[model samples]
Target chain A: MVGSALNQIEIRRLVKAFGNRAVLKGVDLTVAEGEFLTLVGPNGAGKTTLMNVISTLTKPTGGLVRVAGYDLADGAVAVRRQIGLVSHKTLLYDDLSAEQNLRFYARMYDVPNVEARIETVLRRVGLWGRQRDPVRTYSRGMQQRLAIARAMLHDPPILLLDEPDTGLDQHAAAMLTDLLHEVGATRRTVLMTTHNLDRGLELGDRVAILAGGRIAYQAAKSELDAEQFREVYYQYVKQRV
Target chain B: MPLIMPYLRKVFAIVAKDVVAELRTREMLSSMFVFSLLVILIFNFAFDLRAENQKTLAPGVLWVAIAFAGMLGLSRSFIMEKDRGSIEGLLLTPVDRSAIYLGKMLGNVLFISVVEIVILPIFVVLFNLSARDLPLLVGVMILGTIGFAGVGTLFSAMVIHTRAREVLLPILLFPVVIPVMLSAVKLTAAILDRLPFADVQNWFSLLVAFDAIFMALSFILFDYVMEE
Candidate 1:
C-alpha cells in the first residue's frame, strides 16, 4: 500500500544459523521503497535474527540480502548510511545525556549541521527540554523516545524497529504510537517486528507473518481486516503445531 | 586528507564519548586508581623497600601495580559497553572496526597512564627510591602501557560476552602481555639505576617492537573479532 516500484529491501533464500542450530531457514521477502511492513511471528521465529541481518549487525549464514540497492556484503557501510535501527534495547549509553548521545552518533555518521539537526530531532520526539538530562534518569518511555531520535538523527530513509513497544506502559505505548504514525507519514521505508498483532496491523500499511523462519502470509491493509488477519495468523500457528 | 578527516573525527567522537562517560561516572577510573593505590600500599607495607634491594625489586612492584590496574580498567571498558548493549550501537555505525579498537585502546591507555602518573611519585616517595631518570621512566611506562592496552583491548572485546569476563580477562591477558611486562620491568630498573642508554637500548627496542606488533595485530584482527 503506498509504495514506489523500487524495492528497498531484497532478500533471497536468506539463511542464518548459530553453530549447529539454524535460526533462519531460507527465506525470501521484498519491501518497497515507501512501504510500512509489519512483520509478526511467534517467539523463536527468527524475527530479530532477520532484522540483525538486514541491519548488518549479524552476518547471514547463506543467501543474499540487499538493502537500499547495495548488497550487504559488498557495501555494508553504504547500507548503514541508508538505514536506522531501533531494537528492543535502546542501544544508547545510559550515562550520557540525550544530546550528547545524539551528538556522538551525528559525528560518527558525519552528519552536516550537527547541532541544528540534533535540536530538530529532539524537539520532534518531545525531548528537547530533557536533552541535557542523563538517559538513566528518564523513564522507559523517555529512553525509547530518545532512542527513536538517535535512530533518526541522520535522517536515514529506512528504519528497522524490533519490539520497540516492549516494556512500555499504556500511556507510553500511546505516545509511541503517535510518534510511529508521524514516522510513517514521512514515507520512509519501515520494517517493524512485533508480537502485538493489532498494533502491528494498525501501524503497518501491509502485514506479513513469519512462521518457521519464512514469510508464511502477506496482505495489504486494504485486503485484510484485523479479523481476517487473525484467522490467517492462527491458521499458520496451527499449521506449525 | 579529506577522507582521513572524517575518519579521524569518528575516532575522536568515540574517545570523547568514553572520556565524558568516565568523567561523569568515574567508575572505571576510580576503581583502577584505588586498586593501583592498594597494590602499592600493600607492597609498601609488606616489603622493606630500602635503597639496597629496592633497585632489584622496585621495578617488579611498579609494573605489577600498573599491569593489574590496567587489566581492571581494560575489562571495565568493554564490560560497560556490553552491559548496556551500546557495543551494538557502536557496531551499527558506518565507521571501520579499527576505529572502535583504536578509540577503546587509546581510552584504556589514557586511564592507565593517569593512574601511573599519579602513583609513580607515590611509588618513588613510598619506596624512598631516587628516580633520576624520571622522564625516561615515564616513557617506558607509556610505551609498556600502549602494548598492554593494545592486546588487552582486543582480549577484553573477545571476553565481553562471556559469563566470567572478569576472571577470563586476566587469564587471557597476562600470558600474551608477558613480553611487554618483562621489557618494561627491565627497562624501568635499568633507568632507575641510571644505566647508560646503550646498556638498555635492546630492551627499549624490544618494548617498541612489542608495542608496534601488538597494535598492528589487534588492529587487523578487530574486524573479525567484532563480527557477531
Candidate 2:
C-alpha cells in the first residue's frame, strides 16, 4: 500500500475561481510515478491555475487534490515537499551567484551535504564555470538551467514544469527533454504544461489536453497518432471557444 | 525541532542574502541615507528657527524624515525579488508563507536600522542637542520600523503588479500606518523632552499594539499578495 501510494497524484472534481470567474471547473486527474504526463492547453484554459493548485501555491474553491499520497487541503506542506516546479520565470536572484542561489534554496529545503549537492547540480546543468557569477549576468538559457538546478536540488519525488521550454533553443530544449527522461527513469512522476505539441508527445508517456477548465482528452502517446491528437485538440478548443 | 525549523532557516537565509546583496550594491541604503540627510537639511533651512524653538520641532522633523526615507528603503526591498522572480522561486520551496513575510520584514528592519543609526547622530549634530534618552528613542525606532516594514512589505508585494508602484506604496501605506507614525512621534517627543515613562506609557502601549496588529495582518495577507 505504501509503495502504491508513493507512485500517484490524484485530483477529483477540483474547482477554482477568481471572483465569480471560474478557471478550473470540476477537473479530475491521476498521474502515476515514472510517468511523464503533459498538460497541454490553449491560453486561459486554467492549465497554470490547475498546476498552482496541485503545487499548493493556490487553494481550490472546491474539490480534492492529493500529491504523493498527501491531501492538498490538509497536508499541503507535506505535499509541497514532495514536488518541484520549473516555470517560464527563472525565479533566481540576479544579484546572487548561481551557486549562492542554489545553496540558499538547499538551506531552505534543509537538504544535507548542500555544498557537494550544489556543485554536482551546477555541473550537471553545465553551469559550473559560471556558477560564481550573478544570475543577472547569465543568458536566458543559463538562467533556465539554474532554475532547473534549483527545482531539482531537493530531490523531490515529483516535478512540475510550466512551459519549461519557453526561452530555450533547440539544443537547450533537447537537453531539457533528456533531463526529463533521466528524472522519469528514476521513478519520479513528472507533470508538465507545454505548447510544443511535438515535444510534448515525444517526451510524454501520457498526453492530456486541458480545455474549458477540464481535461478534454488524455491518452498514452502510443494510443494516438500526432495528426489524430492535433485534430482532437483543435476540435476540443474550437467547441469550448 | 519540527519542520518549521527549516522554514525559519530559509527565512533567515533570504534575509542574509538580501543583506549581502545590499552590501555589495549599496543601492537601497545609500539612496535611503542620502534622501534622509537631504530631508533633514531641508527641514533645517525651512524652519530657520532659533535653538529654543528647534528643540520642540526636532521630534516631528526627525520622524518625518525617517518616515519618508524608510518608505524609500521599503519600496526597494522587494524590487530585486520581484524583478528576478525570486518570490516565485521562494514560493516553490516547501517553506511556510509566513516565513517569507517575516524574513523580508526582518530584512527591511535591518535596513531601516542602518539608516536610523546613521541619521540619529547626524540629527543630533545638526540640531545641536544631545539625544539623552537614546534607549527610549531606539525603542520607538524599533517599534515604528517594525510596524512600517510589516505593512510596507505586504503593500510592496501588492503594488509590484501595478503600473505605478512607487506612487502606490505611499498612498496605500500612509493612511494605514497613521497609528504607527502617531505613536512614534508621541514617544519621540516624550523622550526628547525628558518626560517620565509613566506619562508616556499610553504611547508605548499604542506603539506595541500597532506593531502586533500590523505584523499579524501582514503575515495573514501575504499569501494572497503572493498569488499569481
Expressed as tens digits, the lDDT of each residue in A167-215 for candidate 1 is 9999999999999999999999999999999999999999999999888
CAPRI rating of model 1: high
Best by lDDT: 1
lDDT of each: 0.91, 0.86
Q: What is the TM-score of each candidate against the true structure?
A: 0.97, 0.94
Task: Report the interface RMSD that candidate 2 achieves against the true structure, in angstroms.
Answer: 1.6
lDDT of 2 at A187: 70
State the TM-score of the second chain for every model.
Answer: 0.96, 0.94
- lDDT tens per residue, model 1, B151-186: 999999999778999999999999999999999999
Off by over 4 Å in 1: A1-5
